[model samples]
Target: MTRIHCLVAAVLMSLSLNLQAEGADLYPLSSPAEQERFQALTEELRCPKCQNQNIADSDAPIAKDMREEVHRMLQQGASNEQVVDALVARFGEFVRYKPQLEPRTVLLWATPVIVVIVGLLVITLVVVRSRRNTETSSALTPEQRRRAEQILKDAEAP
Candidate 1:
């Protein structure tokens, strides 16, 4: 009886798991035009809750809602740029995964490249300074070198 109960429980758990794994019914791609527009818009929109995922790929409730909104706007004969503009006007530039190139976002886009260049310049300066120091030390006058050696020898004796 215990073994039969365990078997039944396992079967029920598997069935429930399968049911929960069913794919969601996203808006049907009714036409190629609709699909193209959906694809283009989704790629641009960010998932507000997910830092790295776009709305189209995100399964978050907000992402689904945003996708539905985009579809509705497209169906209403809105141009892609118009739809994007509306979203930007409502949610701000952060709604887009890649923000538009503008003076406001210049720092965000340029920071990595600027940092790389500055870092390279710093590294070059450090290497050159090190080489210069080594060369200067090697060229120390004989009297100075002898005095430096004697000072080291006196310190070591203690």
Candidate 2:
């Protein structure tokens, strides 16, 4: 049982190590512009499989395919926008690090700023309310203090 567990662990470690290996630049470019475009697109497009990583930096098979598609489209004289739109159509807006500001995606772009503003407002309100409560609670009239003490004494006696 231990030997089987050890073998499984070794295989998993080896697979994880392979995942980190850099994928070679296998797509040959005929022009410097194509090369630059390829580099930019790969860096700009996110890997569908690795949500956090751009296609250029990811070793996932889907990233490899996306890179190949971008190279092919650029070779055929597609504009950067054309290539990006094609990828977005296939993989959804999640493929772009910065999705365009369409009505559907405006919320996606605005959500972070909105969340931060809302959070700040909520925190400010909480801080103000707490300060007001403390200020109001801190000073009691002599009559109120005496009444509170009398109540406490009655409770203790019961």
Candidate 3:
């Protein structure tokens, strides 16, 4: 039982060490500022393969390559904007988590508001039409009212 416990402990320790080594290889920033920049940049950049996930949280190969490229650029004394611009130039605006508000993206930003306004307008028209129909239906013509009264009297006589 003691030997089994020792073996289990040794295995857990080795696994922990291997995990640490793997994590260490992922971030090779030399300074605190470089690390901070790396974290910020990774979070700001979206993974192309994983459309919803940032590069830092994605396990895709493209994300891994982007992380390596960011580290390399930072190591070579690149500014945050410089690294971001390089990536943007290579991958286009889709890779950016926060797209810039320019002419091209104006439609993208305005689409939700436009949809809401159109929906409200449709609802207003529907409600107005429904109210008008109810009002028109309730207002019977003189001939129609007389016919209705005669029908009611005949039914009562029977």
lDDT of 2 by residue, 28-47 (tens): 78877788889999999999
**Cα distance off (Å), candidate 2, residue 101:** 1.8
lDDT of each residue in 39-145, candidate 3, tens digit only: 89999999999968999989999999999999899999999899999999998898887788899999999999999999999999999999999998999999999
Runs of candidate 3 with Cα error greater than 4 angstroms are: 1-17
Clashing pairs in 3: none
* Top-TM-score candidate index: 3
Per residue, candidate 1 scores C-alpha lDDT tens digits across 33-79 of 78788878987898788887888788899888888888888877788
Best by lDDT: 3
lDDT of each: 0.84, 0.90, 0.91
Better of 1 and 2 by TM-score: 1
What lDDT does candidate 1 reach at residue 156? 98
Per-prediction TM-score: 0.69, 0.66, 0.81
The window of 10 residues in a row where model 1 has the poorest summed lDDT is 20-29
For candidate 2, what is the lDDT?
A: 0.90
